[model samples]
Target: MRLRELLDATELGLLLLVGHDTDDTDDNDGIPPGTPLDRTISAVATNDLSDPGRFLTGGELVLTGLAWWQGDGDAESFVRVLHRAGVTALAAGEVEHGLVPHDLVRACRRHGLPLIAVRPETSFAAITEHVLRRLHRRDPGSLAGLAALVERHRRLLTDRAAPDSVLELLRHTLGFDVRVLSATGRQVAGARPPLRAKTAAALAARYLAARRAGESAPHHVTVGGRPYSLVPVPAPAPVRVPVPGPGPLPHPHPHPHPAELGDWLLVVEADTSLWATPDRELLDRTVELVADARAAREQANTARNDLADRSLALLHSDVPAEEIPLRLRSTAQAVVSGVGYWPRLQFVVAAGEWHAARPVPAAALRVLLEEALLQEDGPVPVSSEDIAATVDGDRAVLLVLVPGPSEAHPDPALDHAALERRLSAALARWLGPADSVSIGVSSPVPEPGNARRALEQAHNALRIAHAAPGQVTVRGPEDLTSHILSLLPLIPAEARRAFATRLLGPLRDHDARHRTDLLTTLETFLDCDASWTACAARLHLHVNSLRQRIARIEHLTQRDLSRLETRLDFLAALKSG
Candidate 1:
C-alpha cells in the first residue's frame, strides 16, 4: 500500500505525525501519489539496531520502537541503513521513548523517506496485522475485478460488438495472449502479430481432431513447446426451454455432438490445469462471448454470400454488358476493396468424389479454397479477395480478380499456377489419395461481361481435369488437345457413336469376320507415327506385310493415311469409339 493510504486508513488514523515533503517538487521519495497500492509487503521487520539492512529485501514498511536511539548519529545511521536497504517507508513507535525524536525525523527528511509516528497505544504487531490483511485482500479483489471485466465483454458482445473488438478487449483487460480459430483451423480472429499460417492450421487441425474424438474442451495441448488450452465454442442452442408449460416439452441440445461440424475453438495461451476456479470461470465466459461473436459474423457472411451468388447469377444470365457492371458493383466492391473496375477475372471450379446419391462436399472445398488464399507463401496471396460460390451441389466456383500491370508481380498465370499447386496439396490432405478432387482454373477474362465465357471455360477445364491422370488439371487456351477432348463430352452419345461407326465400322466388321489383325495394325501404325518399319516391328510382321495391311485399311475406310487431315480424322474416330 502507498504510505498515504496507510496514514489515512481508519486503523492507523489515530497515529499522527506523518512526514511529508516540504518542497513543492512532485517527487514523494521517488514514488508519485497516484502509484498503485498493490505492492505487497514482503515481510514486516522490527529492529532497534543501528544496522538492520541485512534483514530487509526491499518493499518492507519497516517498524522501529526507538529503543536503540542514543543521539542524532545513531538516528542518522539507522535511517541511512533502512534507506539503503530499499525500505518503502519507516514507522517509528513512540511507546518507550514517549515521543518520536526530531533527529530521526530530520534524518528521514534528509534521506527522502516517508516516516510515520506510531501512537503510544498502537502495538507493532497491530500495524503488521493491518498490512497483511490488506495485502491478502487484494487477491479476492482482483478476482472480482476480472469477473467484472469479463461481464463487460459479454455485454459488449450482446450489444453486437465485433468479434475482434471483443478479443482485443479480453487481451487488454486480462493480459492474456489468445486466438480464435474456425473448425477448418483457419484463423477467424485474434491473431495479433499473426501466427504463422502453418502453425494456425496445425492448431486448428488438432482442435478439430480432439472434437472428433469426443474429447472435452478447455483441454491442454502444446504448440511450439508452449502449452495452450483448446476450448470448443459450440453453436448456439437452437431451442429455448419453456416456462413450465403443460404440452410436450422441447428438448434443447445444449452441447454439440461430435458429428456436427463448424464449431469454433478458443486457443488460450496458458494451461487451464494450472488456473484457479475464477480464472477457469472467466475462460468459460470468454468462450461464450466468442461464440456469440462468431454467430453474428456468420450471419453477416451469409448475407455477403447471398449477394455474391446473385451477382454471379446475373453475370451468367442474359444481362447486357453495360448493365452487368452496374449489377456487380456492390458485390465486386465488397469482395475486393478499392477496385473501380475488375479489369481481369479468372474462374476456378472445384469438385470431389462422393456416392451417386450423396452430394459432394462443395462447402468444404470452398472453405479450403478460402484458407489457401490466406497463406502468405501461396501463389495468389490475394485470393482472400476472391469471391467463391457453391454454384452447385457438386462444384464450387471462384471469381478471382486478376492483378493489373501496375500492381506488384502482375503475372496472373504464375499466381494462378502457384495457387493451383497449394490448393491441390491441401485438398490431397483433406481428401486422401484414394479419393480425389479436381480443380480447373480458366485463363483471365477481360471483364465481368465475359463471366459466362469464363465459367464455361472453367467448366470445360474441369471436365478435362476429371479425365486427366492427376487430381488437378489446368486447361488454358494453349492446351488445344485437352480443349478439343473436353468439347467432345458436350456431344450427344448417339451422335458420337454415329460418327465413330461411320469411320471405323468396316474395319471392325472385317476384323470380326475374317479374324484378321487389320484394326490392331491400323492402331499400331497410327501410334508409330505412320512408320512402316516401326509398325512392322511392333506387330512382328515384315515391312511388306505392314504395307499391305495399311493399303487394305485405307481402301476399306476410303481415307488416305498419308494426309494430315485424314490422320487426325482417324485418330478422332478411334478416340470417339
Candidate 2:
C-alpha cells in the first residue's frame, strides 16, 4: 500500500511532515499542494521502545507516541535505529507530547526517512486496522466472499454437479466468461459455444511457450478475432504410488507422476495485463479451483482404469476367445456394453521418451487417446469407447471400440486415417521439443480372437513410425496396406529419399506452392487404375475435376498417366515417400 492512500483518506487526518516541499493550501481541502508520497509501505508497526529496531522488520510505517525521545540527541539516536531497521516512514503521535518535536523531524530528514504525523483525533489503532485491511487489496468482507465462493464450488463437486454449473457460477460472480482447455484443443468446460478448435490449439501453444520461457502468466494473445488471457492451471501434484516389494516397508512414492505436457489451462476473453491486482488474484483463484476440479475428476476414474487393466489382460492372456468380449462388457467403453453387442477393437500402440523429464506414463497417453476419441458438446465426459493400459513400461496400448449403440447400428467401422490424424495431433500436445513418440494404429478386427493379429499389426506400424522422421510420427493400417511398405523400411533412408524425391519432387513442389492435393490425388488415381470415374467417386470430386487435376499433374511432372510404367513409377515413389 502507498502512504499516499493513507494521507488521501481525509478522515484519518494524517499529514506528511517531510518528504515534500509544498505550499500549505486550503484549496485542496487542508492538504498540501505538491505531490509528497513515493515509497510504498509493506506493513504497519506500532512501537514506542527506545530501541525499537529489534521489534521491527522492513518496509513498516512505524507508529509511535514519542515515549522513546527526551531531547535532540535522543531523537537522532532513535531515528538512526528506526532507519537501521529499514522502516519506510515514522508516524509519531502528538497525544503524549502535545506536538511533534522539531528535533524528530530534523533527524528523520537527516536519515532520509519519510515522516508522517498522526493527528490526535486519529487513533493509532485506526491506522493499523486500515493498513492491514488494504494489504490484501480487499477488505475482510471481500476476502470472506472469495472464501465463501470457494466453499460453494467444493460443494458443487461433492454433489456431483456438472463442471459447467460451477463455471456458470463463476461467470455470475466474476462478470466474465472463463474457459477450461486442454493442450489438445479440447474445451474441457466453459462458456457457451466454446472456443473454436483452432483457437484453443493456438492458445495452448502460447501457454506452453510461456511456461518453457519461465515467463509469468496470464499470457496474452489475440485469436478468433479477439484478445484472450490464458493462465496455466497448476500441474497436479505428483501422486506417490506404493512400491510392490517383499519388504514390509518399501520406499514410498516410488513412481510419482509429474507429467508436464498435458496441463489444464484457464482462459478469459479480456486482456489481463490491464486488470487490477484484485482481479489478478481472482484469476489465480480460478486456476486453483479449476485444478482442484480436474484432480477430483481424475481420481474418480480409478475404477475405469482398473477395468482397462483387466480388459487388456484378457486380450493378451491365453484366455478363451469368448472370454474377451465378456471382460470388455464394462463401462470403460462408451458403447452400450450390453449382452447382444459384440466388441470390435482398434489397437493403438504408443511409446515415447523424455530426455531430462519424467517418462511419459501410460495413463497419460490413455487420457490423450480419450481426448482424441470422444468430444463432448453438452457435458464433458472423460472417456468413452476407449480403454487403455500399459503392457510393458512406457508403452501404452489403447483399445477403442467402434461404438454400436444397438446391434443394428451401421457405420460401425472406425475411420483409421482420421484416427491417425487426430491421435498424432493429440500426442503433439503432450510431447516436448526433445520428446518423440511412435504411434502404431491397427486395422479394426471384428472378432475377439483376432485381437492378437491386430496387436501385431499395431506393433509393426509402430516400428515403421519409429524409423520415420519428426518428433511426433504416426503409422497406421492405411499406410501399410501395400506389401511394399513392409520392405520399404529395410532400405536405407537416404536411398528411399533420393528415389522418391527424384520421381515425385516436381509434384510435391507444385502442391506446396499451389496448396493442392495433387500428390494424394495422384496416389488415389493410381490405386484406382487411372479410372477417372472411380478416382473421382473416391475423392468426392467430379470426373472433370479429376481430369483437370490429372492434366495438371502430367504437365508438372512431364509424365504420361496413360502409360503403365509411369503409373507404377509414381506408385513406387508414393510408397517410398
Top-lDDT candidate index: 2
**What TM-score goes with each of the models?**
0.50, 0.52
Q: Write the per-residue lDDT of candidate 2 for residues 59-111, one digit (tens) a residue.
A: 67888889877877788888888777667778999988888999998887776
Error of 2 at 565 (Å): 30
> Model 1: clashing residue pairs?
none
Cα lDDT listed for each candidate: 0.62, 0.65
Worst lDDT 10-window in candidate 2: 25-34
* Model 1, span 1-577: residue lDDT tens: 5565677777664453434444232223644243323333444566655676645546677777787897767788888777676677788888878888989877777766667788887776567656645554445545564566567667777766767755654443333567887655666788466677666666766665565445677768888987788888765442111122234222222222222234567877767676556556767777778888867755645544665577667866787765765676656766555767754657777776522222235655555555544544444445344444545545777665555443755444425455556545433333324445567776566545445555666676677676677654444433434455667878898888899899999999999999998888888876654545546778999977877888899999998775534755676677899
Please report, as a residue range, the 10-residue window in candidate 1 with the lowest summed lDDT.
Answer: 251-260
RMSD to true structure for each model, in Å: 18.4, 19.3
- What lDDT would candidate 2 get against the real structure? 0.65
Counted clashes in each candidate structure: 0, 1
